[model samples]
Target: MNIAVIGTGYVGLVTGLCLAQVGHYVTCIDIDTNKIDQLQKGHSPIYEEGLDKLLRENRQQKRIEFTTDYDMGLADKQMILLAVGTPQKNDGSADLGALFSACRAIAEHLSTDVIVVTKSTVPIGTNERIQDYIKQHAVNNNAVSVVSVPEFLRQGSAVQDTFHGDRIVIGGENTEAVETVAEVYQPFNIPIIKTDLRSAEMIKYASNAFLAAKISFINEVANLCERAGANIDDVSRGVGMDKRIGNHFLKAGTGYGGSCFPKDLSAIIAYGRKVEQPLSILECVQRVNEKQMDILAGKVSKRFRGLKGITIAVLGLSFKPNTDDMRNAPSIPLIQKLIENGANINAFDPAATETAKTLLSDKVFYYETIDGALKGADCSIIITDWKEIIDYPIKLFKKHLARPIIFDGRNCFSLKIMKENGMEYYSIGRPAIFPIS
Candidate 1:
């Protein structure tokens, strides 16, 4: 398969490199010459595990290329995947300026019969809109077929997710186009979900909504467990043992913070309003997640009275481990609230320190090591569950901190361990443990 993936961001770069890894000749096209130049040197502009190595190896194998020329990139390509970003607007609707512009360029450049598959998350009827829009603008109006194939790759484990995802959904009204898109993934041997274009678009939004709902639901349960004197760990384990509900996303934590869930859920609610249908449940899900971000902050403010003139050690910055993405990370609002209350903050993350600087600026102190952040701090707050933070010995807090209090957001440490170590621990939906002193 000779394929051109447009817009070399997260989705575009991953899709292009992964497809090329499977013996397909893939060319990633982007308008940014700097980004194209970086890829040409076997460098990935964004941080993703295994991406640079795979991209370099594939380039060496003559299977993949990168370009800024639309005509040269789109020419002679059998499949053109629209992997651009559809960022959310203030009203929660997706801004389609990038998608529309790419379609116009594809219309102008496409030369042969091609299946134009959308790998981006788009609203219902977007595929049809693209098809109609391209026909109106494409010189070869009769030769393009649009298919909807939304991506379900998780950030930290995108490479594994691409090769190991349980199913792949490829939808279109055109039978030939749909199968051609499906055949693109035939090498992976995943289950094929054949459906109409609208259903495929809805599936992506619905999946993100349900997962977001699950995180919020567990946080709610954790809150109830705290009030009722029940153990969330035990409750979640018992609940997950049932055949119906698996254990994924059952962990009681601060909340989900990343690009997909927040934006997709908001977009769905906006789409529902645009269609004159109400999505109250999704709206509530968003509300709950928003409040969950501040749970630790509330705990800190209530316990410490004013937090003025206090130095607090903070751990973790990125939304998840193995990636440096800080979009919608819970640490942002929590830290901002603490700073607003006049608390001095010291933070550390294994991978997110530099990225955190962009979002947080010089408002907080960044530490080279976890111990440095905790040194002379009154308390430690664990935000992201990076392995370095999790594996750090509990006694280090007693040695390094001015006080041994830890307001843990991710529940990475066991309650038993905290109690045994005589460390003060406060976590979501769990019983608070106080220092033995």
Candidate 2:
């Protein structure tokens, strides 16, 4: 199968490479000349594990190419996958400016019948609108069928997810269109789920909303456990033992953040309002997460009687580990709040410092090494549980900070270990550890 993937962001790049690996000739199109140039040289502009290697292999095999010209990229393509970004607007609705612009370009250049599969997440009825828009604007009378085939790739591990995803969804009003899309994924050997266009669009939003709710739910539970003299780790373990609740996003932490959750939840909630189907539970989920992001900042302030004139070492800057995405990262708001209270921040993340620099203030200091970041700080806070930070020597915390006090958001250290090491430690939903006298 010949495929054209529009937009070379995380979704588009991974989709194109993985599809090319599975015997499809893929042309990745992007407006960014720098990104296209990098892709042409077999370099991935984004830092995804295993992406650059796959890009190199696919390019070597002549299975993939990159270009900025729509006519050249879309020539004779059987499927056009729209992987453009539908970012959230101020009103919490999707800003479809990029998606629409891509559609218009495709309509003007398309000269053959093709299945236009939307991998971009959109509102429920947006696919119908896309179909009409493309047909109305097409320069040639080509049969362009619009299908909603939303992607379910997670950042940092998107390549692995694409090869081993649980299911592939193909949604279209036309049966022939749906089957053609399904055939494209036949080489993947994953189960294909067929649905109508609206349901397919709704599935992407509903899945992300539910995952965000789970994270918020566990964070709320962690707060209760802290007040009730229980450990969230044990509680999560026991609760996750249930067959129905087999624990995937149940770890209690500083709430969920990334490119997907925050905006998707807001977009869906706003959609609910527009349609008069109020999603009260999801509304609460959003509220809970907003508070959860501040939990660590509040803890640091209260522990120090306020953050005035304090120098704190922050380990980890990205929302989660294994990727360099800093969109809506909890550390952004936490650092801002600390700075507002007059605390100085020295932060370190293995992969996110470059991206973090754009989102964080100039007042915060960046360090290449975790120990370097902790050196001479008054205290420390663990924002992300990166492997580097987690496996660092425990005694180093005592040697690095002026006072051996630690606030851990991800519970990366054990209470017993902190107590035995003669350090004061606080972690989510666990008893505070004070050094044994």
Candidate 3:
């Protein structure tokens, strides 16, 4: 199969590489010359575990190529996967500027009947709208068929998810269009969920909204546990034992943050609003998450009696570990609040500091080493549970900082260990751990 993947962001890059690894010749197109150049030189612009290696292998085997040329990418391609970003707008609707641009380019360049499969997360009726848009602008009305094939890949583990995802959702207007799209994924042997176009788009948004709701619901439970002297870890485990819940996204923390959840949840709510049916629960989920993002900040302020002039060491800057994505990362709000309260910030993440610099600028100090970031810090905050941070030498916390006050957002450490280590530890839905007198 000859596949053209538009956009070289995490989704497009991973999709292209993984598809090619499965024996499809893929041409990845991106408008950014720098990104294309980097891809051409065997470098992935985005940091994804196991991505660059696979990309190199695929490029070496001539199974994958990178280009900015739409003509080259679209030429003789049987399937054109639209992996472009459908960024969220102010009202929480998807900003389909990139998606529409890709459609127009596809319409102009498509010379044969091609399956235009969308991997971008768009609105429920977006595929229908796309079909209409292409028909309006295409050189030949019969040359294209729009199919909604929303991607379910996670950010850090997208490559693995592509090959081993539980299922794939495909929606199209006709049997030929949907089947052709399914044939591409037939080799993966994953379950294929075939639905109409609207339902397929809703599945993508609904899945994300439900997961985001779970995170928010757990965070709310954590808040209750904190007040009620209950441990969320214990609660999560006991609850997870039930076959009904099965314990995915049940961990209570500083809340869910990333490109997908925030955007997709909001998009669904926006969709509901546009159709005159408000998703009250999902709306509250978004609100709960926004508050959860600032939970650490609030803790810091309350603990330090107004963090004015306090030097705080923040461990972890990425939203989640194993990737450099900073979009909607809880650390952003925590760091912003710390700064607002006049706290001097020193933050460290193994992979996301450089990317964080773009969003956070010089507002916060960046440290290469966690110990370096902790050195001379008045108190420490853990925002992300990176493996290195989780496995960081506990004794060093006692040695490096001026005071051994640690606010852990992810609950990545054992409460017993923090207590035994003689640090004043604060975490979500757990009893505060203080040194034994």
Leading candidate by lDDT: 2
* Candidate no. 1 TM-score: 0.97
| Per-model TM against the reference | 0.97, 0.98, 0.98
Error of 3 at 175 (Å): 0.3
Expressed as tens digits, the lDDT of each residue in 207-258 for candidate 1 is: 9999999899999999999999988988999998887988888898889988
Residues 1-437, model 2: lDDT tens digits: 99999999999999999999999999999999999998888788898889989998999999999999998999999999999999999999999999999999999998899999999999889999999999999998999999998899899899999999988988899999999889889999999999999999998999999899889999999999999999999999999889898788999999899989999999999999999998999999999999988988888888899999999999988889888999988999999999998999999999999988988999999999989999999989998988999998889999988999999999999888898899999899898998877
lDDT of 3 by residue, 1-437 (tens): 99999998999999999999989999999999999999899889998888978988998999999999998889999889999998899988899999999999998997877889899999888888998898898987556788988899998898899999999999987889899888889989999999899899888888888888889999999999999999999999999889999899999999888898998888888889989999999999999999888888888888889989999999999999998999988888778888988999998999998989999848699999999999999989998889999999889988999999999999989998987799999999898887777
Clash totals for all candidate models: 0, 0, 0
Sorted on lDDT, best first, the list reads 2, 3, 1
Point out where model 1 deviates above 4 Å.
none
Any residue pairs clashing in model 2, and if so which? Answer: none
RMSD of 1: 1.3
lDDT by candidate, in order shown: 0.90, 0.93, 0.91
Report the candidate with higher lDDT, 2 versus 3.
2
